[model samples]
Target: MLRTVNVTRYIQPLREGGSLPALAEADDDFKYVLKFRGNGHGPKVLIAELIGGEIARELGLRVPELVFAHLDEAFGRTEGDEEVQDLLKGSQGLNIALHFLSGAITFDPVVTQIDAETASKVVWLDSFISNIDRTVKNTNMLMFNKELWLIDHGSSLSFHHAWMHLEERAKSPFPFVKEHVLLAQASLLKETNEAFKKLLTPEKLQAIVALIPDSWLEWPDTDESPEALREAYSQFLITRLNHSDIFTNQAQDAREALI
Candidate 1:
């Protein structure tokens, strides 16, 4: 389980992506960008963030530290904005907190000379998870300390949205990789796929899925319990791992056009 923190103050909201995430101060004296369950996307986004972001880190990619924040309804009472108050009130309990990268700036591929391998690894990871948010229009990447850090994985792992179609969708290739900001610069798609695919063992996948809070996994429509959903996610990842080549080739083809 990720470290749990108590949110002490409700800072202002950040209207970055579709989700209205907010900056808040926690008990640990650190600020974090909090993704609330009350948002339109709901708890599945949190589940994706946990599994997708952690999987990226375990694969040797850079990611921000995650913390499970405990929110008190009182914070909502203090918020002046009616919209934010509603958001806070709806998310009175647990939320995902991304450790604030205070001075980090949004990554701009135009000025950055990213190495081929690094870009490919990121593109490969995005393709593997079927993330549609890493396009040139919205990279979901930040630069801090002269290094790129991936963020906002709430949109990854979309197969989980419908359990009935998950397996079939798992094997489908991600065409959106062509829009990935790094695809043009990525040169080692096959090499990165071969190297990192081994890291996602069944045990490792299970462990990563287990980190998601049970509350987030329980959907009213799904008959599968949290543990069952976790296992399903693990299997989906394993299956997706086997199907990596198709997407890797797609990335390579797109890279050719871009370069």
Candidate 2:
């Protein structure tokens, strides 16, 4: 489970994407990039962000520390912007945040080259989660202190939006790997996939899925309990990891075509 923090101030709204995440100061005297629960996708996006990010970290990738940010009901009452005010009000509860990287710049593949191992790991992680982002146009990666850091995983695990035939979805070939920005550089897919499979055991996956907030799992008109939802996510990931070869082969073939 993630440590909780009280949001002290709203610094600014990050308008990079539709979700409208913000840069804010927390009670711990540190700034964080806060993902609100009031966003259009609601808590589902937060759930994806947490699961994808933690899994990446466990796979030895650079991911910022995550925390559960709390918003008071009156936090944004005086804001003159009606749009911002409504968003704040609706998100007056537990939200997700990442430690803000102060001087990070968007990753430019042209300027900086990633080695085969790192690129392969990133590609494998993205494929495992079925992440739709991380294309050449929008990498959703940052270069902080000359090291690559991943962020904005809200778009992964899209199966949650329509939770039917989840096991079938887990076995998807993930042909989208052809468009991944790092696919060409992921030359060690086979080796990396085998190594990563050992790192993410069923117990580790269950622990990660258990971090999802109970409130977030309470989907509208859904009959499933939070525990059941967590189990579903865990099972989906376990099944996907077990059948890693489907996507690994897809990625290897895609990489071969590029080369």
Number of backbone-clashing residue pairs for each candidate, in the order shown: 0, 0
lDDT of 1 at 225: 85
lDDT over C-alpha atoms for residue 225 of model 2: 99
In order of appearance, the predictions have TM-scores of: 0.96, 0.98
> lDDT tens string, model 2, 1-259?
6899999999999998899999999999999999999999999999999999999999999999999999999899888888888889989899999999999999999999999999999999999998989998999999999899999999999899999999999999898889999999999999999899999999999999999989899899589999999999999999999999999999999999998
Clashes in predicted model 1: 0
Where does candidate 1 clash, by residue pair? none
Where model 2 places Cα greater than 4 Å from the true spot, the runs are none
Look at candidate 2 and give me any clashing residue pairs. Answer: none
Per-model C-alpha lDDT, please?
Answer: 0.87, 0.94
Worst 10 residues of 1 by lDDT: 160-169
Q: Point out where model 1 deviates above 4 Å.
A: none
